[model samples]
Target: MSDKKFELSRRNALIGLGTVGLASAGAGVGTSAYFSDEESFEDNTLTAGELDLFVDYWTGANSEAIDGGTTGSGQNDGGVSAQYVLNDVKPGDSGKLVFCPKIVDNPAWLWAGSSGFTQYENDLTEPEAEVDDTGGDPGAGNGELADNIQVTVAYCEPSDDLEGSDPSGPEDFETVRELNNPEDYTLTDLLLELQYGYLLDGYVEEGGEWVPTDDGAYPASPDSDTQTGPCICIEWNVPTTVGNVIQSDSVEFDLGFYAEQERHNENPTSPYATGTTDDLYPPFDSNRALGMSIQGSGGSGSAEAEIHNATSGNTAFPFGNANDDSDNFPADQDVDFTATLDVDSNTASLEVLGSQAGGTDVTASDTDVTDGQGDGNALGSDTEWQNGGIPQTVDVAISARSLNSDTTTVKNLTLNGTSVSPDQLAASAGPEQTYLVLQGIDSSAGNTIEIDGTLNIEGDASGWSGIDGLVINWR
Candidate 1:
């Protein structure tokens, strides 16, 4: 309530890339002030007020000697750097560490009706204090540091994780606190606070159907007399295509476990402004973004597939996240070609359905076509051809590896035992980088292809890549 923020920092905590670091633990206390003014009769005597809130944590691994004791498993050096080390990390990687924060025997108090009333009761509830309720209102009244301690996490650059530096500096802290709670109190709230707080970026494709379901993630809150044990498990994932531009990019942070006296409610109008101003301190905020970063491997080799639209190995396919419905060709040239290949009978059929400027639509079938896994021998779908092209069917075998690649070549395309459009085959194969985007495999079909004007392909649905529902159906 005092609007005061207590920040703790760690310097050079090394969490290596692609590895999880041990849990870090540390603690500190917030202070309170008492003022007594004598405006009474001659024989009036007074004593000083008392208030002390202390908090400390024990890392899952080691216990150290801080406030004197024999040097145990580790050194209780104090501050964040003494707790744990977070090293190099990348996207899609996660790490965890557990620790507990407990309130030792400490003194706490709250002001009654007015500021400085000095009529102290047992704890916060005993007094049942009142707030102004006008322009600014003090939050709900609860006694002890249990209700007053405000904890928040801030993001910064690794270079800024310094000693004695103001971790709250605007330049150093990210404005948006990623750790947030949902609008309502659902099972997700418990799951987020207890298990997935480390997921700074919410649920991605990585978390397959990880919807929130209550299974005892968050325990009950601690009362004034008891100490609550909450674990802070920090995690990071390295992306598959991490390269030069992304290399060495680090995200530094400061987890400020702040505590302020509820006395602010007493001064309702002035300095004792009740409650914390930091948005990250709100209740049920496990969804708050964890300030983190993933370093790049600095390796190279074209992390993307090449889309060839024409010969000369140039004229790359102009495919984008959206469909280019505007680019419609008018007249049809000698562009009508079609072929149907029957793998079982080793027979083929060729027909010119229509005319087109480019290669005609082609359909390929292989009795042995499968997901390249155990599910074998199914009907193959037809290849989609763009730009006023007629459909052509071919009998051949296609593998999953070739489908996932950026570029694939259908060499020596033949019709009636003669080469048809060899150059066009290369172009089609190249642009079909994610050509393997399929839905569930049909009983008779090897793989259900998702393409424009096809049942498998949803014209309006969108996928993560901005492409239209082109999900890779990996068996």
Candidate 2:
């Protein structure tokens, strides 16, 4: 590790260069008899360590009216504690609020834009808007900003964080991340797009004409880069077409600023020459960036979308309040939690069966059924007996295979949502199979049967863990 202490300078002078030869000449006879020694010393001084980052709201063209102008202070400035807020903001409101991130004591490298930054959206789409420059007309090429709310960033003078206009001079700002084209953005894309080396209206004078340049992007540096400024101006916007589905919607985020040694940027580690334990132990050091949370509440009279179940799939049980009515549900309510099972009579038969007793093959006799019940291979020759058509003697076979060393209990069976306790289901312990039979059934269309019970799982159950809702439909 390098020294982190601040050092003071000590001055010393050497003035005996020519005297060395003269002194030796006179003492040539006995060199050691007239021995003389002179010593020169220099001090090694170190500088103090520094890494700091901060985020604050920038009141455009006026620093005194930062936080609603009540006391002319932004959050965390002086005694003010209220964070930056954008209220009653509808769509198409551009440049509503401007903020700046400041770094000092060390050079800061930042990551921004949709590619690197992430904002949680509660799984809903963000509001979309047209580029503010398009004059509210989204027909312009690459004009649409997919999210209902959008944030655009530009480099600005470090000393003045309140500027609303883009940087005009080459020395005004440094780009850390580049913004994405408006058309390529999604509703969930990062609100703030910071494109390195790309500027908003960024240009330079060459001869008589202004040539475009990468807006705020520049190389990383250990010391502050004088060619560009240290602060970035951030803006937010809402378009007019954003509907009420976003009503009462909100957005919160943390802006990050990172600082690392410039040495890493110049000579980074590669696969061939990865660092040793000592070199990689400390990882990298950086100061924490101060964060600010800005919240925007949607307008009143917000509408909601309706929820509907699939028409063809298994029936979906109601989730708490989602089944209350057919209209809209609150955006912040829990909707679904029930387990589902969909069964069709066409493929509801258990085609696989086996039986064992005392380590002997007993399936041949135990799995077959005579009259109604049997012990060995008790499945009757007639397979469609359980099919509900004209009410007749229906032989319903039940088989249980125990995967572990403990007995499993087949709780209760239900037919048409009504309990039928006489049909018992149980699997013996340790690879043992048990069978039961039902003799009467009107298995027909609209008749539903299900095993409504829990499996008493033993130390280990490889085949069947348990069943909560196992249903078979006869349609």
Candidate 3:
């Protein structure tokens, strides 16, 4: 995994002699091809021409062209730049590019070759560590670039229906039929497949032997009609959804396009493939290196923490003493409301001394007690509302633990006026069904809470029991 560069120029691509090497084989990008032909003795005196391949470039839009000239021992047909070079890429930076492999003198079977892939993490920084989730060893070549740059390789077909195809009208074959298809691969995956003679090559093992897969492959580019063949297009992107995990990272590799005479030839896999391509395809493994990145600078921001004391003021009630209280502040309640309720075990310190066995004595009193319902009529048997006039229905809640028995009863215990739910009373167990329960009671007026219950314990007490917590939400 040494640092390598796959820089290929038109000048170098035209020299096809020793180009059969792979990226790992030392050279950058070059095509590897060999064709077979038979002599036709029909014409004694004959004119012959070597089969050749020329590649032209279009920036996905078919708006501009870069003639790579003849990629076989021919000089440049110079217009602008003949090859693509991506630099200073950023998130959301994406588009497609087209490559037209123009065959001359003869139609040729072609195979796309890519090899010598390398990825570098570059100088890791704090910004990168903040978002990077690769969990790989630092300072290693396990960068995130290749995995973040998604690549969609598909054969283009001319159509007037694709968006922005009017420039070439019906003859524009640049519509990416399946650019964002579910089977799209990242750059690393795509390159790995191409190097192994698998992707879009039309040749795969069938019936226990290597054979041609007629579909999912580009037909041979004909020598007779240059404009007829479909263009091989690639749609690349560091998707907008990608984040800073790829920051300060980079990758390099060689994109090799190969070709051979189509006559009497069927299986044209990559030239650099060794042993068999079957072991690497059908289902790719998970050993992948891909991610997105961003360089340079921008603005910044920061954050800190603070503290508060709920000892006094609006949040100071049981709120300061009891964080579990559901009571609200004076301002939070109705302006006409002027009443207060105090019910805290440790704070109130109320104790009722009664007989150890069967007895009907469990009477307790608090500052304010409505019939646990919203009907706020204040006085008839209990105290009067400190404010005045007849009030509205008052909603009440209680959290208490009383020592008693299972058959305990509290008269007029209507939790809310229509309190018919068994959930209104919950218990903590004693020695043999003896209990510490919570129940509501009503006063002479239908709206006062009287805590009067009769205990019916028939056995010894003292057991492990206590209600953990309770919360009843009104839906």
Candidate 4:
């Protein structure tokens, strides 16, 4: 029936702004402690034992170096720190932290939780763009690092040296124990799991989810005159296979500790419900693009491409992987693309297929073909792509440079599965960025677009021919 907290005040190990530094906090209200003697009975009523909690912390990185905590001296300062922080972390880098709790009075039920989970993409990198969740886009998307970093937490006994510093790994500790069969959760998933506070050993995995145990979290031991208290050691690392997608990302959160009176508390539940990433990455994602497969059938030239979105430029229109490619076609790739430009009828055709990530066959409901690739979507779970991201149609420009001798020509332009000829399209010098507007397209079978044109290269003409560009953008 009381409303006061006998819990240990929280010391934040915050994640900083820019590069996502591990900033641990330990300073709290400076109220001194009051302990009771081993007395059997008091005046008229039985005296309840005191149960105030305190904390001591330690951190380690790749070199197993101490980042300043209760490290050197044999005394526990009760989690005092100017800034127990670690910066300049990299991939394949693994580290551990021990947040030891002390009752300073009596043993009690302990709980652990996290809050203020924030993340930001900050800057965009190509490797990251390739594997990001469906909804994230540079600057306006979730961060990648936290989701890529995997963590494992366990209960442990401090090292024999009491130095609390491990040069090799947690194995140097006296004993490294687990809470049931704990899974190696990514930092992102772990944050969600700890939102409302986990009852520590008091929580168990039932069926498939983690829930509060019947008897509640186990009563963890507190510090004594001769030994340190049971420790909650968290070890985390970025896997080598995760690639460079998480570069230049940042994440922040607060690791908190709580305690309740075990003498009466049953089915303990935490009130801490703060689990939102400042800017974290979605676990699964994809991009808005012109999905296609190119196949050639009888011709002298090729127009092969599956890269590029709705807004690609004319230069990359027919082949490049999006107009943004620095080295287009045969330059960035090692293989040759093949598509036929009919030599007899002088006609060339290309058919491309479209279907959003996890989209089905539009075989019948082919009404309004989605106009543009909307803001990058969280494709899988969301199960839908919104329209109006980039323009649905592009201005297929055709400009050319010709030497003396003969001439190479392009005519009878067909776009978006329709035949629309302008200026008779019949050109001996290749039109200069011609503007042609085609209205209403058939979006059946997932918006399949077919482009057909006539090509006439006369007298070994001293000229070149190819699609100019797509003229849209990169999602």
Model 2 lowest lDDT segment of ten: 16-25
- Top lDDT prediction, candidate number: 4
Cα deviation of 355, candidate 1, in Å: 43
Better of 3 and 4 by TM-score: 4
Clashes of 1: 35
Best TM-score among the predictions, by candidate number = 4
Q: If ranked by TM-score, best first, what sequence of candidates would result?
A: 4, 3, 2, 1
lDDT of 4: 0.37
Model 4 agreement with the true structure over 215-294: per-residue lDDT tens digits: 54443333333233456777778777776566556565556566666556553435443212322211111121232222
Decide which is better by TM-score, 1 or 3: 3
Candidate 3: where is the Cα deviation over 4 Å?
1-43, 46-49, 60-83, 133-140, 157-173, 179-184, 198-225, 276-475
Clash count for each candidate, listed in order shown? 35, 39, 14, 30
Report how far off residue 417 is in candidate 2 (Å): 55
Q: lDDT order of candidates, best first?
A: 4, 3, 2, 1
Q: Compare candidates 1 and 4 on lDDT and give the better one.
A: 4
Q: How accurate locally is residue 125 in candidate 3, as Cα lDDT from 0 to 100? A: 55
Model 2, 283-387: lDDT tens per residue? 111110000000001011111111110111111211112233322112122121111111233222111011111111110111211122222111211222232
Expressed as tens digits, the lDDT of each residue in 433-453 for candidate 3 is 111222222222234322221
lDDT of 3 at 417: 39
